[model samples]
Target: MQIEGSVAFVTGANRGLGRAFVQALQSRGATKVYAGVRNPDRLTLSGVVPMRFDLTEPASIAAAAQHCRDVTLLINNAALGKVNVGALDTAFIDLSREMFETNFYGTVRSCQAFAPAIVGNRPSAIMNVLSDATWFARPMVSAYSATKSAAWSYTNALRVELRETDTQVVGLHVGFIDTDMARDIDAVKSSPDFVAHVALDGLARGDEEVLADEQSRLVKRTLSTEDGYYLDPPPLV
Candidate 1:
């Protein structure tokens, strides 16, 4: 799908990679971008319209879908992580639940709510910002990784389900990005602007999957190891 003049709804657009997505789409000549955020006031982006949305709330998702009826592309960019690393510990179970609720259930809700909008526009698309952790385990972010893995699986199923409709579903997998989310992590991170550029280009070119950085490419190449190296479960201890 051509992004120029296409309407897009990007969640978590108040900052970080989400903010970059808004700018990237605008730079590509998107007609209108609905920057969805839980706290709309935090978004002061001049060219985009701010739409109030808390992804974990089904009603809020529906409201945003209704509010952005012209949206041809839905970008699932929001995620939740724990304050501490050991999410497998009983003490962090609540955070684990919240992570899944926000990262997995919330994504599904957004997809359902926006399907009509995308279908109405016909031949539109959905871009899910997944992570390389979907394949490789990140011990410190075990719970967060689990959530993204679920999203990765769901995106695969969704791609097949939407094939007949010609509504492109692009799954984007990237390593750590130079955003607040990866600020303290030592991993080499890509700039959010670069990730957005590659992702949008992949979406327009009808690419089923986009590995945005070298780390993501490495993970994909290693996924077929005989020992299932890339699929290892996060260490609990």
Candidate 2:
């Protein structure tokens, strides 16, 4: 779990939290980083190599796997959301399939392709980026919530499956961050750099999960609360 001299592959590294992850890894003394993105030409990391990948594409994932076979640390960070948001909106429902394709299966496929490499480099780590919404449903972004929840389930299942392997699986759950993705939201957001630091630190310390913010901790605590929790449904148009 030591970051020093480690080789890492981070998807969606063009911007947002993914970029922060790359920076954090490098700052922690990572020897190499394959910064995966849909468009690698735009990537500007000095010490990091730009890796072309579209998580939704099997061919791309395979190629990335082949290229980054030496990776010891893997970060599943790529995701997609609808171009627009609204209540009972046809746009969201219409894009539900697309959203799940990237948010859920995309991560799943990436994991499948990279797991062997991680196993080869026993005692490595895989950090799955999740969300506080995995614990509580949210309206407007109901589709995204569903996909994140599926990822949360997958992370738990993978943790059990990889229990005997050298690969350490860590799930990262956090509230909204001040990323381009959440730019429209008015809620208080954590910085991507802070989230990345906490996540990597947790992994090195062998923590099972990284609760990146107060909101994430609050939501996770409620999962076992005796009192029933309430969540509102998606708003109707």
Candidate 3:
């Protein structure tokens, strides 16, 4: 789990939290950092090597695995979200499916493709970027919340499955982050640099789950309470 001398492959590394991950890994002394992006031309980071791939494309996922055979840290950070304005509208269903395609199934695909390379590599780790949405619901982002919930479940299962191999499976959950993904949201957002720092710190310490911000930590603490936080919708401002 030590970042020093490790090889890391991070998806969605062109921007946002993914970019932060690439920078943090390099700063922590990773020997090689493979930055995965749909368009390799977009990657401007100096130290990281860019690899072209899309989460929704099976071939791309397979190719990345084949190409980054030495990667010991697999970070699944790519995600998409489309607003679902109305539950009764067909567009809502379509949006939900789209979100799941990237957030849920894409994560599974990445894990499946990279697990073999990381299994026998002692001190290796897999980090899945999840969200506070996994534990709470909001009308404006219902579809996103659902997809994150599914991903959270998958991360838990993957952790247990990879237990024998000693490959650390870390789930990173946070509320809104100060990234393009939350550009329009007015709520307080954590800086991507700070979030990435906490996530990498958790990985080094072999923590199973990292709640990156106050909101995420709050939501996690309420998960086991009777009539949990999810029971009531937050009042709209």
Q: What are the per-model numbers of colliding residue pairs?
A: 0, 1, 0
Could you give the candidate ranking by lDDT, starting with the highest?
3, 1, 2
Encode model 3's per-residue lDDT on 1-237: one tens digit a residue: 899999999999999999999999989999999999999987798988899979899899999998888989999999997666645556777889988999999999999999998985766999999998898878788889899999999999999999888899999999989998888877889999999999999999999999999989887888898977777747434
**Colliding pairs, model 2:** 123-166
C-alpha lDDT values of all predictions: 0.87, 0.86, 0.90
Where is model 2 poorest over a 10-residue stretch in terms of lDDT? 228-237
Winner by TM-score between candidate 3 and candidate 1: 3
Which sections of candidate 3 miss by over 4 Å?
Answer: none
Give all TM-scores, in the order shown. 0.94, 0.93, 0.96
Q: Put down candidate 2 lDDT per residue, 1-237, tens digits, no spaces.
A: 888988999999989999999999999999999999999888887788998999889999999999888999999988875444544767776677888899899989999999999989878988899988777655567788878999999999999999799689999999889999988777879999999999999988988799999988877776776752325423323
Predicted model with the maximum TM-score:
3
Q: Cα RMSD (Å) per model?
A: 2.3, 2.5, 1.2
- Candidate 1 deviant stretches above 4 angstroms: 83-88, 227-237
Q: Against the correct fold, how does model 1 do in TM-score?
A: 0.94
